[model samples]
Target chain A: MIRIFDIAAKDLMQILRDRKTFLFLLIMPIAFTFLFGFAFGGFSKGVSDPRLPVAIINQDGGDLSLRLVNLLENSEVITITQDAAKTLADYEKLLTKGNLAGILIIPTGYTDALLTGSLPPLSLEANITQTAGTTIQSEILAAANRLTSAVQTALIVGQTSSAFGPAFEQALSAWDNPPIRIESTSAVVQTGPKVSSQVAALAQTSPAMMLQFAIAGLLTCGAVIVNERKTRSLQRLLTTATRRSHILLGHYLAIFVLLFAQFLVLMTFGQLFLKVDYFRQPAATLLVAVASSLCIAALGLLIGVFAKNEEQAIAFSLIPMFLFSGLGGAWTPLEYTSATFQAIGHVTPVAWAMDGFKNITVRLLGFESVLVPCAALAGYAVLFFLLAAWRFRRVSE
Target chain B: MLQNAIEVKNLHKAFGDLKAVDGVSFEVAQGEIFSLLGPNGAGKTTTISMLSCLLRPDEGDALVMGHSIKDDQMGVKSVLGVVPQEIALYNDLSARENLTFWGKMYGLRGPALRSRVDEVLEIIGLTERAKDRVGKYSGGMKRRVNIGVALLHKPQVIYMDEPTVGIDPQSRRNILDSVVALKNQGMTVLYTTHYMEEAQELSDHIAIMDIGKVIAYGTNAELVKIVGQMDRITLTINAESGRVLEAWKKVQGVKQVTAQDGTLTVLADDSNQVLPRLFETSALNGVRITTVAIQEPNLEAVFLHLTGKALRD
Candidate 1:
């Protein structure tokens, strides 16, 4: 209705006039997004390859140990460190200091043991606290498996086919090279919404901070409501031909538009500058963003309706904001949290919004993949909006 | 028969145990300024709110322009404009912006809304300052804009609940004049104020309310006649004595006399006749009259007579 638009226009004009509101809506969200993005090293996904540092203590000095070291270097996961020359004690000290991912200690006679078909006494010293240690250990096991298989095949061929020495040598080389091999068919499949280092750091940082600042931005909306009530503008409005719903819709529309626009600008900035791929599915991202802003703004309206004064309004806006954002994993990814905590985090709409964003930015999924999160957010928006409307009508009457 | 612009019948509202508006009843004939006069906490605002369709009556109802406030609130609201006690204009918005928004709320649109906003801005004498934000204006200017918002619709009945409260004298005068102008233009107005002088100056019909009830209701002259002709005389004498008071009571037409310090006040039927005798009596008593003054009977006296309390009390 024209009346609703008039009310919304008036509220937006008031919000724009407030400098503190402007800061929260755009400036603070973008600043925090950038801060978190760079801090998490998420922006370096395509820029550079980051490898873990590990020491290979090859006391064996055998051909197998040398080949193992070569495998470690070529894997692109762990770079061989010169610390391998130090004793195990020194390597353990480096791991404890958080500088080394792991140390691969190939004992002396490792190749002879492998040639004799004996299990070698190999030890890996690693700091399991860092995930890179786990990754490096896996790479080591895979390399060892390939080498052991090759050696066993050579031995079996030498025994069964008693050709001459030169023929045997040629057969051993052929086995290692493999004239016909079992080819692997591989394609990267992302299960659910997930974030990778390749995903722009802003991918998570922008939505998280936008969710945070959207709630924080309620300070302006709550203040407007309280101020209007104090000035008796709300009571005066009731005396006009305007319905109470019209007045509430006006306020609701203002908060929704402000928050949605704030999110769009920040997400766009992230995509343009920080290389966050929120625009991978622009329409889906916009849907999630709109739903998220609606839910957040509806909550802001409820706070405004319940608060009697400006001080109460501030407290009402802030306490719930911090509690919900902190619990819902706005400051950290829910995926990294304990299973129990992730379940609890899903109780807040922030988690759903983050999931929807991660689907597009990290998994690079299509619109259908984000529907669940977007719908959950919309449900919350509807619930909050209904509550806000009921309370608004009660207080106004 | 002249049509009544608004008819309030036995309206009552209670908050918890406190009866805010208790069985109050009155009517405003079309094209008249009817004033609800009361002191603070006298329920004037509550009564106005009920009639304006902002508050529902607990026991009764009122009809504004034949629209029932209880059932047809939207219809009643469309026909009535309310100026509350507080200056309800948004400080962040310009005068024109506030008026335009309010005009739309009152169902005006497009060119009609703009023209009406312009008309109200001119009427409030703030057309030149309409572009400026209300916060930058003086308190009086903001009050004018507040009233201007209510006038945008030009409704048949306007309810002003202490519209002049907490503003400059000039602004109060301007608002009072506007109310008179509204009545002259054949619009009915229900005005409420705690100031007795404002009620006396503006109302064609006055209802004095107290403790959630209408204590008295009639025209100014009719209400003034409640208290018979009586004048108060204060004599600042050079001497203070119970004997001087007794001697003044002996004078003709002097009904009551009380002396405090060097001043003696005499309540008499006719102050002019009592003055000459008071001078003679004072000379006879060797009480030198340093100064003498007489007070006229007005709304203050009428209120005191009817309620046994001063109008400002």
Candidate 2:
């Protein structure tokens, strides 16, 4: 047996001396919170109005073609830029640089084709560089196709006006009616529901998970452990009365404290700057934060034990953490993805944490909804810690 | 019936097929500076590691301060301090902080820990640079801190494994002085080194080891006596002294004679009897000797005579 506090004190002082480690533990998490909170948090649940940038190069110098371009400019989804000098080359350049989403080319023969009821295939070029850009391009193409069909139908109806005026007028009025119907239905799909909040608390709680993974990948804990081993400081430590358990527990405790501080900073920034209602149930949030920190700390220990050097540890920790966070919906909320992908996210602790936070902040669910994830995270913590301890003992022996 | 600080009997440890320490046995009395002198890969480290309880011997038992390393590992570890060949101090921290951290591991705390840190810094003569980061320290300074960490626990027996391997002459002297100071305070030191001079100067009882076995073990004088009967003499004379060498070989107890480039070397049982005859023969043969020297038996000579190889080789 050895005094754990003594070891903890030393570990803390070492962390304080390393400036890079200090920034990783405390600063990086807050920066990530702001980054993901503003970028992806709003789109987690379905964005009702997305301002997608679009560009239109109108080659047809006709009144009808000009009217159609105006319609695209007025839509909420499309922020149309009109550049008469813009060519296919210029549009492609913009797409490569990520400055343009999709290009709309109204060919010179479009008006004549519509008049003669012989529609040429309108070229709707999409920037396939990113997934979001592709989705926007598809949506804009669909809306434009609908508008063209409406115009063709009107032209056909007007040509047959002399034969049946009253019947054709009724038909034209019916066709003039908007075909798309949007019905807002609030179906509360709560696994475990709470009465205090109308809006699902789970939706708001999802953003906090980005905070969790960012903190876990911080360089201090595992990097320091690997550094000690490489420098043979650990061998010197073994010569003393300090048990292996003391050294491991000391690092574990430091990671826990550092991650907890990171969680608070992220939550505070979330509530104040982003106006995210993460603190609706303070107790539930705190429970999730503490459990997540323990899980991440255990992960850090596993990295430290398995890695032969500091560089390897840092690489090993960051790569898996980044992948898991991205796949688990911490990088982009799991809600927007397919159900299969969401299920895959459950394998990651970050996904479990996101689920727990979503229950509290989005679904307004009680502690019951978070029980499974919290328990799973705790289980991971224990398993990782045991493995780390076993590895540490083996190396020392 | 002498009390021993450390005792190992028939110690054999095998890493797969290679026998690192094969049937090695030795004992060190209390308050004596004993050295295990061997070349690299000769199982000196393995033997010390097992005695320190950092490793377990496959087929032997070691008693460190009357505690069996196999049954009572914690007991052995509690009393033993190891200064490994590598510098193991933390590079990110200050020298003072590193000592304090190590001191805490030994159950020292608060003012006691602080004072001990100060004392160790003073002892290692690094008090002025205590606040500087260890990464900025020279190789010797790092080594001193490494030794300081081992001494923080104040163990009964300290194990130093080649502590002066790559250090300058000045740092090597400081380390040697520190070891002597600790021994004077009644600390039993098991110092291992390939440097014969270090072993001869510091070890009260020296165990000359090779190929995982102790070839010779005793006081320096006792071991030196093995080669004391043989006399080695060298004579530098004028050019072309072939006839002088032929006459010197005929002398009584002069076992071998070799001559090269105006120099003659002779090995004999008694120099006193051979010198008179050698002088007369050289004079009669008209070989004027400029220098004549007789070699005395030392650790280097004893090592060379026992193994047929120099200690440094």
Candidate 3:
């Protein structure tokens, strides 16, 4: 056991001594995270209006319909983009172009139907599968609830008071500053102009890049085994009291420590500057971090064992990094991809790690949400470790 | 009954159709220096590798300190220290760090590991530059660190595979002296080299190998006796000895005559009886012998006598 730690410590020191490790370890991830975030319309914090854009088709030209439009315009969640001359087809095209987050269709008699308490259904055209769609749906639901509360309160007051319109206005205004309000930062932001991206938030990209670069940065750690073989140190090590298992576990532990440290640094960066709230469910985030590190480190070991030289080591690590990151939704959200691709993405351990992290930061779930993802990551880690062990033996032979 | 520090029985290893280490065997008494002398592809490294547990033998086994290499590899390994043919130390790590890490692998820890590392640094004469990265070191300095790592654990037996191959004479001398020092401390040393002089100078027992087989195995004096009553003469001629070679073969007391690099090497039953005949022959061929030196039979002659070729060939 002491020998294992010594090997790991030695490997870590060797890797850390090279200054180039920092480029992928921290610098590239930070630069690319912010770069991709802005390019894909992920962040909109300091804009004139950070709210998501929505196009309104108000066929109901009544007083209630106008008031409802005003209510939606005043929402902090989404902005109203209405064109008096544009038809429904124009609004649909705007929504498809991603200039609008969604389209709101209020039918001609919506005001009278709602005033009569019929609670007629309103049509909302948006991608229910994406984060922006979920945000839009939540905001619209909250606004409709406010109006229903106002109407219900006014009806109860009208049974006794003759000034029902004034009562309704007062009740609607009461909702602006509702008691027991929860202030939450939605991970979705949209601009009215067409964007070639559905870049959701740092909450998604930060962890994704964290997983991706953790593998990319392994260009060094994964080469330790190959370097030892090239330098004949591994053969020298075998002559010591240390066993093959000792060498395997020791290297595995080192790679894990490095990857976990990278994850923590990137996670802290997301929490501090990107408002990703990794610490909101700190335990769940840590669980994912540990499991991901385990899986990635095992992958690093497998690469090191199979690679014949440093060049092969680079290819082994980089190729898998692309495969896992692309297939696992590390480059983009699984929701943005086809359902078949999304289903296939879960075949990679990265998808589970992403799910574990996004469940906390994006879905606003608790520790329980990360348990299955953690288990899946662990399963991948075990599989990779066994393969590495097998390859370690073969290479030594 | 007395047991040798290391025992071997028909150890063999092969790579495809080529036998790297053929059926070979030898033993070393406690506190004695055993040398495996051979040319480059003579399987010295492969034999040492099997004994050190880096390679498993295909046919036989060795016992290090009463532990069977085939059955108890870790046990054999625990009692042995190996310095490979190459400089196997991590260049990125300081000498001290490399020694310290390898020390821990041998199961030393805490203050013991540090002190052992310091002691090894002093032993290898690298204490001053112990903290510098080995990558910045000269080849000789790197070789010393390689030796130092093996000594950090102070195992019962040590295996050094041509530790002085690519270093300066001064560093080579220092390493040779360190091997003697380790022997003086009651440690068994298994040294491998292709240089006949190094084996003659340091070995208590010498094993001469050619093509994966030990052709000769004995002490310096015992092996030299194999070419008994025989003497080697190296005579440099002003001209190539190709013309005089047939004349020398016909001379009395001349056993074998071979020439290389404008020099004539003759193995004779007696140099006293053969020198005058060789000169008479050289005069007949108009080949002037510029310088002549007569040498008693050594390991080099023994290898030549047994294999009909020079040890360095």
TM-score of each: 0.75, 0.70, 0.78
lDDT by residue for model 1 over B1-313, one digit each (tens)? Answer: 5499989899999999999999999999999999999888889989988897888899989888999989999889888888888888898889999898888888898899898898988899998998999989988898888878878888899888888888889888988898899889888989998888999999999998988999888998888766566787777887766658888878889877766556676768899999999889878888778898888766655665566555663
lDDT string, candidate 2, A96-163, tens digits: 44355566677787777656554545555553422333444545555655666777677656765576
Over B30-137, each residue of candidate 3 has an lDDT whose tens digit, in order, gives 999999999889999999999998888999888889999999988998889898999998889899888888888888888998888888888888889989999999
Error of 3 at B259 (Å): 4.8
Q: What is candidate 2's DockQ?
A: 0.44
Candidate No. with top DockQ = 3
Worst 10 residues of 3 chain A by lDDT: A179-188
Candidate 1 displacement at residue B147 in angstroms = 1.5
After TM-score superposition, the amount by which residue A340's alpha carbon in candidate 3 deviates from its true location, in angstroms, is: 5.0
| Model 2 misplaced stretches (Cα beyond 4 Å) | A41-218, B229-295
Model 3 TM-score on chain A = 0.65
- Top candidate on lDDT is 3
Candidate 3 collision pairs: none
Each prediction's number of clashing residue pairs:
0, 11, 0
- CA lDDT of every candidate: 0.78, 0.72, 0.83
Please provide, for model 3 over A153-259, each residue's C-alpha lDDT reduced to its tens digit, 9 standing for 90 to 100: 75656665677666666666655643212222222223222333332466668888888888888879877779898899998988887889999999999999988
